[model samples]
Target: MDEEQLKIMRHSCAHILAAAVTELYPGVKLGVGPVVDQGFYYDVLTPTPVTEEDLVKIEEKMHEIIAKATTFDREEIGLDQAIDFFRERHQDFKVELLKDLKEKGTTKISVEELADVGDRPDTASLYRTGEFVDLCRGPHVQHAGQIGVFKLTKLAGAYWRGRDGNPQMQRIYGVAFETEQQLEEYLVMLEEAKRRDHRKLGKEMGLYTFSELVGAGLPLWTPKGTLLRNILDDFVWQMRREYGYQKVTIPHITKKDLYETSGHWEKFKDDLFRITTREGHEFVMKPMNCPHHTQIFDCEKRSYRDLPQRYAETTMVYRDEQTGELSGLTRVRSITQDDAHVFCRETQVKEEAYKIWDIIERFYAAFGFELEVRLSTHDPANMKPYLGTVEQWDGYVAELKSWLEEKGLPYRMGLGEAAFYGPKLDFMAHDSLGREWQVATIQVDRNMPERFGLHCVNEHSEDERIVMIHAAIMGSIERFLAVLIEHTAGAFPAWLAPVQVRIATVSQDFVPFAEQLGTELVAAGLRAELDDSDEKVGKKIRAAAMAKVPWTIVIGSKEAEGGDFKINVFGQDEDLVVARDQLIATLLEATQRPS
Candidate 1:
């Protein structure tokens, strides 16, 4: 089934679960039941807290309710009547919702009731299954039995309506599927995901960390993680330099007027982190780098010769993300974008886009990802809902579509997925577990130039509009790190690994030799670590492997005496022994960026 239909089915199962919950605990108060990822959950308040062990009993009761083929009765009742009904059942969460509605001018009066007085308000919508009734606006299944296969997954605590100031409620999570086979497959994938969970693996691998005192969503990169990020950033910088991107820098915070001029303040003011100076000047931490790049372009007068002035920066941009939205590196308050903007004449838009597309292909392919293109365009039928006029949007979309087709690249067109300012080509790369991630993006914009009055002198010495192309092969370094960890399962390739080679000695007797060899590797521009711990040889080797180091060099008496290089490569069965010079050459070859 489609996602929406599956949501409906899962939502219906939530009702059965609620019904079974109330059946077992007569006085349990319902908070809210909403459909979640792959399943549904009901926030409930109970005198006795629910634990994981209770899930089986709850599942059994849900099966009983499903067996009865319980029908759901949906009704639109007067606001007062609905409030009174839920009040009698001691559903305080429903009362809070009703009060919120009341404050928003909702009333028990309907159009028919207010025909004479000309005063009407929306009535409350609710659903009933057996003796269990809850407040909801539902598209639930007709009968409880229609929910095919389901499993209660886990339980966690949640606020009444996600407000910290509100009462705590127990959130029960579950998954629903159209078929038992699908359910089984999903469960297996879920287990695999747990094993590949970036948050879990990140900590175990010592890549990054988060501190509550430092606040949520702001990651403190450890030394190892910083190396990995710098490596990725440096590589991208070198790659873009070949594409004529000039490295640039801008301030982290800007006066409110800058964003106001760029239209970001109006659109994302609430999402931005705002600050006020001692002089009462309003400012905001930048949520994106494009607006600042526009200023750089406008700093000097340009001609057709400088039509395509590309600027790139790898810097942190801040956002005030909600606490609930914060995850590992995937979602964070501080985002580092390999952001670049290319200012070109209208005719060069196609060429610039092609260059970026080529970059994306080479970049992701080097990392073992075959990307698919998605052309996100504005909805044709609706012009009022979009950022730009129909003609401008259509041209922007058509250029990307034609460019991809001309290159013989397959792509999918996604309507109503375009950004507010322009249409874009998004590159999606799937991980090893078949989960798709949008890592790279390309956008063609005409609005930003207009907003900033950006123009270049044409052949006739007349001011002409410049098309801005925003391209980033690695959208966000933090997010890419999360994806990379899961994709390679922390065993990064030799070139990208934070610790390229870990030198483990057979004992302290060889510590001097191990350190000397590590120094040589470092001098040759390779990252290597020497382990002089008193641990056994086997333990040291295992330690190096567990850290996912690309190479483990074990130095024993024989190797130390003979000076023969023996290396254990991750994910390889055969041991590698080579001449000292040959090994250094191999290291240099493997660590160099792909051509």
Candidate 2:
């Protein structure tokens, strides 16, 4: 179906849902019911709260209405008549909606006007199904019977029209499909998503927590989460070592002039956290790592051979995010980005861009993620203010396009989405729930190099300006870890698991052996925890499972006497009775990423 037809179908479905609710429960006042991406939802003000059980009954009512195969009829009515009709039915929300639409300069119709009654206010369409009618402009199926399969999925408290000041309305979310099989598949995906929810897994594994007193959108990483972050930092630094990246550190905030020269002061000033010093110099928290890396470039002089200078740093930045947009770990106030910049000759721009892409792909694939690539270009209408000279922009844009084409990489082009300084290739990864996120990005910037007056002495002894490539493989370490938590369902790969092994003893008799084993594991560069609490074996195992340690090595009288450990791997049924040296070697192999 076309987009318009799909929208109408969804809108009609919303009416059906509202009708079902009204039938199942009397005296229900309805708010607006709108069609979303996959299905439709209706907000209702019921005297009694609608529970999960009510949703089931309402869904059954919907199926009964669909079985009736009612035709959808669209009727036009004047604004005054429309208001009066809903006013008589006590649907004050609809009347208010009409008034708000009028305030927004929207035009509609009146039924009285059709009969030539004194200048009818305006006309609007109402879709009718069975005995149910809703204010809507509909393009529905021929009959309600054509709605093959649908399911009520979730319920939440939402404000009327998503405005905070409006009265709170209870929202019921539903999903429909062209086939019953499709609906079942979607339901299965929803279950998987719940299982992989990062908030749920993070809490269960003691990885992170949030507090109302600490404010929303700020996540406090627990000890395990902090350990994971540190390990991730070591991995990235190791990867950078082979790429000719020099590590550098910079403060979290800089004077406003730094951002002004970088143009972030003009473009992203609103999102920045601005502060004033005692001298009244306005400073802003750094949102991007590129400007500081540029300053480091300007600190020295170099020849043409010194071109393509790469600077990599793990930096934390802050942003002011919309309150409603806050999510568990996906959206946050602070981010530690795995950021880098490469200043290279113009001829090497494509090579550097591709190199970054390679690194991003490698890292994501190592964790079993399929990469989706997109090229975000300048949208002339909305992006005219951000970019530089037309010819200069064209040169960089053409080069990026040519590189992608030569590399034979499939990518979608997004218009008007380029960064202020240049065009970028954004790499996206879909989670277990099929939600896509931009996890890595590579951009070619000619403007910054020129702005900084950065040049290298060429073969002809002339100073030639350099081009810069800004790229990040993980985007942000903290966010990536959060994603990883959900992606792995908190059972991280043995290599990256914060506590790789937990040694437990069945009794105090084996406590000494457990401690000794843990120390050995620690010496082998593994994070090992010894559980000698006065808990039963079953309780200790449960605790280790809750912690999401990769392995649980049990040391009982038998194992201690035999001078060996009994290992049980998470998510694997295989158990091994192995020597200490062999166990450490195995772990080392697993932790060593393939080159």
Candidate 3:
């Protein structure tokens, strides 16, 4: 089925799930059920705790409900009547939601799932599927039979309305598709994704670790993980250097006035880690680098000859992310951004943006990632959430579109997805698994320059306003690594692998030779490790494989006595035999970073 149909079906399936749950355990107060990326999840406060084993029974009940072919009937009820109706049923969550809608429209409701409720001041919408009724503004499937195929996947605990100190609700997750084949294919991909989960592989490969003392969402990178991050960051820097980008540094904490001037204070103040000085001065940990970079550009007077002052920095920014929102690398409290900004005149915006595009193309190309561009523009309907005038926004957006057109790059329009200050070209990369990730971005900002009064003396001797172009090749190093680890399934390419080559001896007698070979490989610019312990050769090989090293060389008596060495390549069935010099040459060539 088409995407819209699939969404409607999945949403209906969520209602079906709620119906089954209510029947199985009566007196369950429903929160909300929303359609997510792969499927749907419903949050409800159940009278009795629900276990994973109960999912099977819930699925059976859902199937029975679907077999009945119940129609989804939507009704509009008066606000007071809906509140009383839910209150009578002891669905305190629904009553609270209805009351909030009655008093404050939708502004007071923080639950994202209920934002779509097109409720009038006097009335609210409700959907009825069999005996289960839910407060929803939905265009659901006509009947439960249209749900096609569905499976209850898992369950978790969630705070009511996603707020702390609130009653916790049971969140039941499920996936639905149009056909059995599609469902089976998705299930297989999910299994493979689980196998390649970065959190599991990272621990197994000793890439990074998380400790309770370090707190949630704060990951501590191991030595190898730190090396991997440096490699990626250096590669990005190399590309930026070719475009005349200069490195810059900024303090991690700044006076609150800095962000206030840049407009981030108003929009992202809640996410900032605030600090108080001894004298009671307010400061905030930087959550973004663009604002600080602006100050660097403004530090000196400039002429039009000095236009496009490119400043690049790889630094960690702090954000007070909720613990529940934290995941492996992807979502973290501390984010490492390979951020750069270019201060240029209006005439030079395209040229500077093109330079960034080149860097981005070359960077993702090294990983064999196919990119799809997205033109994220501001929502014309909502002018309050953005900065700059309509004329400014329109001109900047048109300029970005023209760049994409000139490059002949096909892109999708993401309405209402632009940054608060400007429109951006978001690069979405398709990995080996066919999963898409938003990897890089280039934004044209006329707002920040205007806010900071950044300008340069023009040829006409006029103080001409400059434009700021925000560019990030890796966006966030942690998130990019998460994607990279999963995309390669921990078997990174030779140049990118943390441990490129592992040298193991057949016995302790050849330990010196293995150590010597390790030094040679390292001298040849390969990340090599020696397994000189008294473990058996087979065990050492297994250990190397577990570490996902690209190359593992075994040293035996023959190899130790001036003979060609056999190299075992990861993911290959055959072993390559080459002279010592030839092996070093091959590895040096393979491990060379992309230019």
Candidate 4:
């Protein structure tokens, strides 16, 4: 179906949902009901809390409304009349909205804003379904019957009009499909997603934790979580060495003046956490690693050949992301991004971007992540907020888009989504449960160079500003680890597994043998552990399985006598019995990156 038709159907579903809620709870006040990406939601403040069991009654009511097949009649009424209608029904939220609408007259903005800005304070559009009516600018389905296959998926508490301090409303979320089979398929996917939820699995595997006292949005990494992070650090460092990226480190906080000069304070001050030290120096936790890297580039004079300087850092940064928005590890206040900046001459910008994209593709391939690339450009109408000159913005955006097109790369355009200082290419990936994430990004920045006075002499020995390309192969290591956990369902690949091999002793008699085998594996540079805690063999195996150890070696009388081990590969189809030397060689070969 077309976008308009799909929206009409989804909006119709929302109306049915609202009708159901009103019938079940007579005095509920309605908030905004809108169609989102996959479904629709209607916010309501009911007398009693809506639970999962309550949803069954709501669904039944919805089905009955749909069966009645009421035509969605549209009516145009005066602002006062609309307010009176909803006020008589005790929907204070609607009355308040109507009063605001009448008070704040329309302003001329754009075609998109026209609906929101009604020229006539005399009249507003109202959509009526059976006995229920809502103030809406809608083009809904012809009849309620068209909402054929839909399911009320979930519910959550949301603030009215997205204001946290406002009254909280219960939001009922539902998804619609054209056919019953499609609904069934979506339900199955949701079930599978629940099975692989990172928060649930992360806790089960002892990966990470959060404490209410320590505060929200700040995740405390457990010991096993740290091991997972170290594995990623090792892997990325190896890749950086191969790709010729110079490693660097910077402090987590810098003077407020640095952000002021960089213009980040003016543009993104709210997202940054300000810190004051004992010396009375006002500082802010770095929201990004770019400005610090710029300082590194400006530390000394540069030659033309020194252009295209690549500096990489696994840096920790802080953001004041709202507590409500934070999730397991996907969203957090503190993040460690595998960040790098390429300071290159204007002519080398495109090539440098292409090189960064290549590196990202390779890195994602190692972890089995496919990408969707988006070219984010500035909107001319919104140019006042962007830092660089119009000509520079035009040239950089055109060059990046042209290069992507020339290479036959598919990309969607995201208007007005650029960083405050630059245009960027956002690389997104879908986790195993089909939830999309912004994983990596490559940005072309023209403003930062001038801000920091970064310069290199050209062929004629005249100084020129260097263009900076900010790229992160894996955007944030912590967030990426969360995705990785869900993607693999905690079964990490052999190379990344925290404890790659677990040596299980059949009895106390074989405890020494298990320890010796673990020693040998550790010496071979593998993460190996010996299980000799007086637990039964079956119990030890189960515990190792829970840890998601990639391989397990059973050390019994037969294997010890032969100087070999019986190995079982977790999450794999087969087993192999190999001598110590042969096993190490095979593992090393398998773990090495493909050329």
Q: In terms of TM-score, which candidate is strongest?
A: 3
Candidates in order, TM-scores: namely: 0.93, 0.83, 0.96, 0.90
lDDT of 4 by residue, 1-595 (tens): 6667877798889988998999999889998888986689999999988998898899999999999999899999988998899899999988877776786643221223343443557667899998989888788887998776989999998877655578998999999888889789889988887787889988988878899998877888898788888778767777767767899899999998998989988777878899889998899999999999999998988888887788999878999876556777888999988899989998888888888888788878887777888989888876766897778788878988898889898899999888879888999887666777788899988888889889998889899888898998788987888888888888888777777888888899988877877787789888788888888887887888888887888888988787766787787666777886688887666555443
RMSD (CA, Å), each prediction: 4.2, 6.1, 2.1, 3.6
Clashing pairs in 4: none
lDDT by residue for model 1 (118-144), tens: 333558788989887877779899998
Q: What lDDT would each prediction earn against the true structure?
A: 0.85, 0.79, 0.89, 0.83
lDDT of 2 by residue, 260-330 (tens): 88887777776788899999888888888898899888898878888789999987888876554567888
Worst 10-residue lDDT window, candidate 1 = 107-116
Specify the highest-lDDT model's number. 3
Which ranges in model 3 have alpha carbons more than 4 Å from their true place?
107-120
How many clashes show up per model?
A: 0, 13, 0, 0
